[model samples]
Target: MRLSVLGAGAIGPAAAALAASRGHEAVLWSPSGRGTMGLDGRIAAEGALSGVFPLRVAQGLEEALASADAVLLAVPAYAFPALLPRIAQAMPAGLPLLIAPAASLAPLAFEALRAGLGPRAPVGALATTPLTARRLAPDRVRIPAIRAAVDVAAVPAAATPEIATLATALFGHACPAAPDVLQPALANANPIIHAALALTNATRIERGEAWPQYELMTEATCRLMSALEAERAALAAALGYVVPTLAEALHRASGVPQGRLAAMGAAIAASGRAVLGPAEMETRYVTEDVPYGLSFYLWLAAGRGVAMPRTAATVAVLEVLWGRDLRANPLLEALDAAGLPRLLREGIGR
Candidate 1:
């Protein structure tokens, strides 16, 4: 398929490279005025896959999206509302559009698109990004040695089969069927982890420590993460979505030990790799995951009258640090469903 990869950042370039390697024509697009991504097309350094092939890089969103069979927005959550409507206008109505690793809230994005394009345009949201890619340098994206697995579903539920088929065709085995968007959304693990790591280590992070961030993982952090994950699972279960615990997903991603949640966490600590990035809390895992991701979940928990103390506390701390009421951030409030309170407790797609 002719694919236009919007955002040319860490995840976007990695995916474009994969598609290009598979012989598809993939174009990389970056929005204007953000300063161009590096010569390697958004990556900061060179990697094993760096400069391995020729890629078409475009700085304008519309020009790049104009004629692709599919377009994937792999930018951070913060960048979406700023750019998606422009993309929707440039894209053909029938072409499948995807938002990979859409952080926490899938429904909000669908609602945003609906508000902009009135549901005439079709789009898909991946439960998470297809690859766990990192920007190792100015001209490189270090795709994890282990191939990542992605779960995808389309809005309105009925759109899943065709989207899945097309997604699998471009992405091969990396794209798998998620139970539902809610199932995948509930499965997302970044919000708690990022909020925990960033809040707990903000001082060290602000100090610009080049030290391995992974080594900071502690029993307390992991325990808190588990608690947060459980709270989300409770909300999802009540709403008819059963997602695995954070440790379970971590186990699957990194071969967690003894196949237990605690052991899986132990494996993460033992690995001692900075699972979160060293310096920036910027993209899919952080920025996107928080407001749209964590904040949305918090709202649901509150609306459902479920206790999400850790999530609530995390949001409070992060908002204070960031100096914003994240609950009403554009990304968080983009869709503003008239009956979202109802949808959260009893999902529409499910």
Candidate 2:
């Protein structure tokens, strides 16, 4: 299989490298062209996956999509609105498109656009990324761990098996099917975890001080996370979907024991796998997760007549701190909240 990976960030390179290691011909394209610069068409991976693999760098989107059997989007959640439309326009009909760590109902947004865009492709979403990694340099990445199983779902639920097979083939890991896109979208725990960390440690982030993110997951912060989690679970239940708890998700993803939230944090810290917190206040933890993740949750809650006081309060505080209306998401604005539950389960036209 030939894979075309979009985005050139840590996840993109790590994904391309993993695909190459599996004997699939992989090509990478960075929209800015800077991520692939100095790489000379090669990628070096360390830690969980160690290898020097040959890579092909595409000069443009068309070049990347050409001759590719499947397309994997590894970009951040904030990039979805602009990037998805362009990809829909350029991609060939019937090519499978997969979004890893899909959040904020991105797959539904893409499906809504594709109805008029004329593409017949099936769009799939992953609950979280398959690999935990970071960019070490322009051409290198550090992969800390590869997940054992990743939850997946497709827009037109029936296409799930095909997407799951493609995902498992590309990553050499299990890609379990979810009932619908809602299952995977609501299953993501990053927004809740990051919100607590950023709000409690705002001063440290604003000061640009280096700190271990998990080490600072004090009892109070964990309590806040639990409160947020309860709200999220309530929203999911209201929608008739039962998703995993934060503790269950962490245990599945990182081998953290399923116990109290603070104990899980302590175990992660003791294991020496905890990464550093953001050095600055303007990071995906606040920017991407707040508007796209938490705010989206609030939107769903409003449609379901469910109260999410803690979740709403978190969004309000972050908006004040950032001095901007973070909930002004284009995708959420375009959606019909009253009809979204059915739409998410039944795709664009039902």
Candidate 3:
């Protein structure tokens, strides 16, 4: 397998190393063009991979995208609209494009790609990232652990088996074909966790206080997490997707509910530093979620007349904080449902 990872961030380098270890010819590309190309040592549980891996690095996006067997969309979701068209412009119509951990906007991306390549381009979308990772050094990454399961599907449904087969060759049995790309997109779990944690810890993050968020999700915080899960689940169901229960995911992540919450926190502490996400505001969690994840989630709920007070309120607060209304952002507007047939014939508003 020949793989090209679009961003040389923590996850990107880690993935490159993992693929190299698995005997895949891997190339990494970063728009900024820094970092040595290597993977060393085995990955630790809940920590970044150790060891330097020898890998190829490309400085430019076009160089990375050219002639690659598979291209992973690792940049922030906000970067998608601008970068996607460029990728589409030069990418071969037959090449496979995979979106790592794509959230609720699969429909929009499928529409865009179809519009670009005439609905016949071979494109695959993933519901979860293949590996959990962090960059421990400029040249090295720590793969905490590969995910236990990965769900992926092709955008047009016809490409699912072919794309899943290719991905499984690189990722092993962890990757499986989903019913459709939309299922996996809606199933991606980061939005629920990030929005809740970010909103909860805004003051600490803004003040640059060294707050331990993993340890902060206490009994009380866990309760709040359930409410957040309910909000996401409601929107997901309305959009015709089923997501895993928060309790089950927590159990998988920390072996909790089987033990006391304090012990679970202790277990996470015993595991050493776990890099959850980017340390900057320009992170995908914020930049992507505002438009793709949060706005989409809110839109689905609003379309169904289901109140998403928390989700909507958070968007308002974050828009003010960020000095931008994400809902009106260019990509968000482009991806909006546009009353696609469901309402056009109803004539309810008129």
Candidate 4:
């Protein structure tokens, strides 16, 4: 299969290498073009799979989009709005476009793509990122773990089985089908883990303490994360899905032992895949996950009259600490149950 990997982050290089190892062709592209530099059309990979993979870097986004059997957007959630449009304009009709680690990103992309491409275009989301990797260099990545199974959902929901089959074939693993986009979005584990880590260790991040994030997690931090997870689970339950808690999610994805939150954190630390924590509060934990993940959860809770005091409190504190309003995505604010399913199935109807 010829796949186009959009974005040049750790996941992109690692995924490209994995594809090549499976005898599939992959072309990587960076939206900013800066990420493509230092890539001499090859990948030096270590960790889960070690090798020097011969990779092909696309000269431009259009070039990459035009020459692919499928597309994978392995970028940050914030980049979705800007790049999805360009992708819609150039993507071949009927091509499958996947958003890795969907986490509420699928709806936005689905709406954006269908506005121009219509309802038949295959746009879906992965429940979580396919792999955990660290970039050693521009063209080198260290992949510590590949997820055991990734839940996937498509816009029409009927297309899920087909997309799941395709994903399984492409990744050489199980790709389960999610009931809806929201199921995968709420099931995301990053916001729950990242929020607790960043807030509890704000002082450490400020001091530039380079510690393993998962290894050093305290009982207090775990307790707080559990509180947030409870609220998230409540929201998911209200929405009709029995979502897994943070600890369960960790165990399922990385083989972290399930017990108390602290025990899970310790296991994650010893997993050899644990990476260093953020140096400051300005990192994605507070910025991206808070807004896209936790904040979105709070917003949903509020409408349902569900009490999410702990989740709300964390966001409030982070807002003052970061000196920015956390719940500020206009698109999300505009969403409600009455129009949500329609928007998910059809385009924005513009």
Candidate 4 lDDT tens digits, 248-310: 677766786778878877777776778898887668888778888888887777667788999
TM-score-better candidate, 1 vs 4: 4
The digit string of per-residue lDDT tens for model 1 on 84-112 reads 66764566656677877655554445445
Candidate 1 residue spans exceeding 4 A from truth: 33-51, 104-121, 145-147, 174-176, 256-276, 280-286, 321-323, 332-350
On residues 292-340, what C-alpha lDDT tens digit does candidate 3 reach at each position?
A: 7777777667657677887777788777766666785454455546553
Q: Write the per-residue lDDT of candidate 2 for residues 1-350, one digit (tens) a residue.
A: 99999999899999899999999998999988888988888999997899999889999999999989999999888888789889878888678889987888788888777776553767888998888788989889988777778889987788889889989999987877898887888888889999999999988999999998878989999999999999999999988888888897777667877898888888887885677889896798988888888998887887568999999999999888878787877866667778776776677843
Computed on alpha carbons, the lDDT of every model, listed in order, comes to 0.64, 0.86, 0.63, 0.78
| 10 residues in a row with least lDDT, candidate 2 | 112-121
Candidate number of the best TM-score: 2
- For model 3, give the 10-residue run with minimal summed lDDT: 341-350
Runs in model 4 with CA error above 4 Å? 330-336, 345-350
What is residue 95's positional error in candidate 1, in angstroms?
Answer: 1.2
Per-model clash counts, in order, read 9, 0, 14, 0
Lowest lDDT 10-residue stretch of candidate 4: 329-338
